[model samples]
Target: VEVSGLPPNLNRSCCDCGVYALKYIESHMLNLPLDLINEDNIREARLKLAVDLWAASKDPVLIDRMEKYEPHNNSSDIVDVS
Candidate 1:
């Protein structure tokens, strides 16, 4: 639905678009109202995300994924930076 009457939207028209997108998916999945996440409560959402990630950090799968992400197989691979 192109709104010709309205001015064209420039790039990054919406601030924190990624945040909004993640919130949209979360709301849709949880059957929660999208309005639950807004500018005022965005910080709360981020804090919750941080808490969730921190809690999951102890999960073996997540730890393994992080381990694989480091690509350095041996201690010799790491340069000794004094």
Candidate 2:
């Protein structure tokens, strides 16, 4: 969504859209079989989604913003990617 590229204060719509999608997916998962919802499968799915999303964006500012997001827990992981 273009809202993802908006300033943080203006990004609520995009963030809520993502949250809604996740809630919908979770509801689907709950009704699905246990044999298909493994941790490895979820992780792989997340990675693939992230890669595909990154590939779809052409904005340098958004790219730079994404580089600043740290997946690990630590202050040193912080980066001024912008």
Regions of candidate 1 where Cα sits further than 4 Å from its true position: 1-15, 64-82
In terms of lDDT, model 2 sits at 0.52
Q: Write the per-residue lDDT of candidate 1 for residues 5-76, one digit (tens) a residue.
A: 212342133656666667877777887766576677776776787788899988999899888885646665
Alpha carbon lDDT of each predicted model: 0.67, 0.52
Clashing pairs in 2: none
Worst 10 residues of 1 by lDDT: 2-11
Model 2 spans with C-alpha error above 4 angstroms: 1-35, 59-82
The root-mean-square deviation over C-alpha atoms between each candidate and the true structure, in angstroms, is: 10.0, 16.5
Q: Which lDDT tens digits does candidate 2 get at residues 20-57?
A: 34534664657643335333355555566678777769
